[model samples]
Target: MADNLRGTSGPCPACGHVVAFDASTSTDMSVETVEEAQNVPISFTRPEMPEEVMDMTPMVDVVFQLLIFFMMTAAFSLQKALEMPPSDNQEKTAQAQTLEELENESDFVIVRIDRDNNITVDGEDAPSDQELLNKLREAKLGQLGQGVPGRTGLLVLADPQCRHETVVKALDAGNAVGMERIRLATVEDTAF
Candidate 1:
């Protein structure tokens, strides 16, 4: 009986919208009831596309874990640094003036290391690295031949045959005790 109306166009009988609907075409007229229409399978005239949506929860979790791992490890690392003198000529003039000013204001804390790895601070022997640190701290606080209370400068007179690690240890001690001005020089055996 529905085929008798084939190719015929008419106004919508359900919503009364005056829409020109063809009988042969698919529309809500084919759906008998709301509950039964929900059970009907969808038919497509073209090829069906696949759903390939990606899940980012695991990726975001891994990124946050790596960030936390690096942050925790970064705290346990030791940062060693050394400040070098200026290289340009204009800065050299400024550096010379600074040296002259320091020479007038305070005496440097002198540390000497011989070829046999013997360390001395102001003519006193420092048998160990801890002793060297203690002596450097004292020098930074005690009167450095001046009426002032402390010496910010440190001078290391090292012999050529000494180990490089020994020199590094001396410099590290000076830096630890807040000695801002550190200078290194080579000395002959007779000079000590």
Candidate 2:
């Protein structure tokens, strides 16, 4: 009978009896009349709630670190530029010459680089870099005998499809042979 009435709080079905319980106290129950149970007062309590919070210190620190890294690695200014003298106003400056005019000049030693990246000196094929350097040295010495010490110029005529490294190598070879005056010319494309 007690098991069946464990959680019940109304009048008993078998008899006209009222039962009351105090959960704060022991399991011992109390029997009362309906009128007496109605006269008793009941109390309730609200449940407690937890507080919510968020921390942003670590996130702010990481953002500042990234900003500092980028600021330190960024390029802010350019390096120094080369210094050149201003042009003379009194002297009459000559106009630029065409490729044909330059080619016709007898003082220039023509060095041609074909589309196949082959270096040729005065229209003759140079087998290797050493051979080309020797030929350039001999030409410079020969030009010296003609009253042109540093006046003998080197004109490099290169095909458009030739590699830039090959042109640089040719320039280096010319410099190695003590050729002071060097000029570059780009050949017109005939594919169109």
Candidate 3:
């Protein structure tokens, strides 16, 4: 069937052509606006950005530092297990022995208090005093739940420069967990 519209096959009612142009949707704006009607006003100013593209030197440095931090923190298996040698004093020597050395040994709970009061357990740093206690409790509970033989103990390695308050806090934490087998590790020459 033939379609009825403005132009079909042949042209020539207005400006003669065989082709038909698609109409635009926008209204024609031949007139000027109030702003444009006025004379060329003062130019609005904008804050200037850096003319040259910014160098990423500082950003790269920070990224490298973060990378280094991650690299340094990445966990690795020890080449050989650490062993504590027998001390001259029998009491210290007996206490110095690791759980692995004991025949009917139980899992040990290790608490390390650095000079700055930073607490570490099983080679992992605890963020706060509460966290340290929680960790100690978990470790103690884990040992108790294991149904292992012999006595469970908590070994605290304190730095010589560690504050008295920090040591007391560690003691308090150990006490909170009902860990009585507490042994303090100190350097031979260091003043307590």
Candidate 4:
């Protein structure tokens, strides 16, 4: 039988701590009754709230504006194109002051026109201007493979006092054999 006390004592269901209940009424209730009352189910659901959406139009507009700004600031073309002859392997030949005497000059055939308009190839004097032009033509057509990319060409060194006519002749010889690359030697400290 249950005690006739008007209040009851028991462990709290929520905190597990000892709790006391009033039992001052006409009948007394047991600790088990209070424990059972405390064990009733409780719902723990949050209140419903409306969902939110973010706008992306402003972010996309900013990206497009940045793209346009970069495109407008970029360079479109080069102002000048430098046309320079290919540099020969420097180690293969001993460098000479003039193109005519380059040691171990196996590829390039030098054409040096002196102040007196005398022409020489590899230190050997040419009999005449016509002979030098002929040798250049032959080298271009057969040995140098003129008109082809990477084909070797003539390195002409015209003395400062050489006539313009001599330079024109040398250029003509180069053009005749389809040799487009012509390198000229210039003395240091000479005014342009």
Each model's lDDT: 0.73, 0.69, 0.60, 0.60
Rank order (by lDDT, best first): 1, 2, 4, 3
Rank the candidate models, highest TM-score first.
Answer: 1, 2, 3, 4
- How high is each candidate's TM-score? 0.50, 0.48, 0.40, 0.37
Model 3 lDDT tens row, 1-192: 112222223343434444332233323322133233222222345989868988899999999999999999999875532234455675654445653343234555666777677778766788788878877777776743343433357777778877877877777777767775666775322322
What does candidate 1's lDDT look like per residue over 1-76, in tens digits? Answer: 1443445433444443433324565554564443443344443258778989999999999999999999988857
All models, RMSD in angstroms: 13.3, 9.4, 20.8, 16.5
List model 4 lDDT by residue over 1-192, tens digit each.
Answer: 134323555565666766555555434333334445466443446988878778899999999999999999998984433245576687677454544354235456667778777776545566666776667766655543333223356676778887888766776666665566566674322321
Better of 1 and 3 by lDDT: 1
Q: What stretches of model 2 exceed 4 Å from their correct place?
A: 1-92, 143-151, 189-192
| TM-score pick, better of 2 and 4 | 2
Q: What residue runs in model 3 are displaced by over 4 Å at the alpha carbon?
A: 1-106, 143-151, 188-192
Instruction: Report RMSD for candidate 1.
Output: 13.3
Pairwise TM-score winner, candidates 1 and 2: 1
Model 2, 47-120: lDDT tens digits are: 77666676899999999999999999999985433223366787678588888887887667778888888888
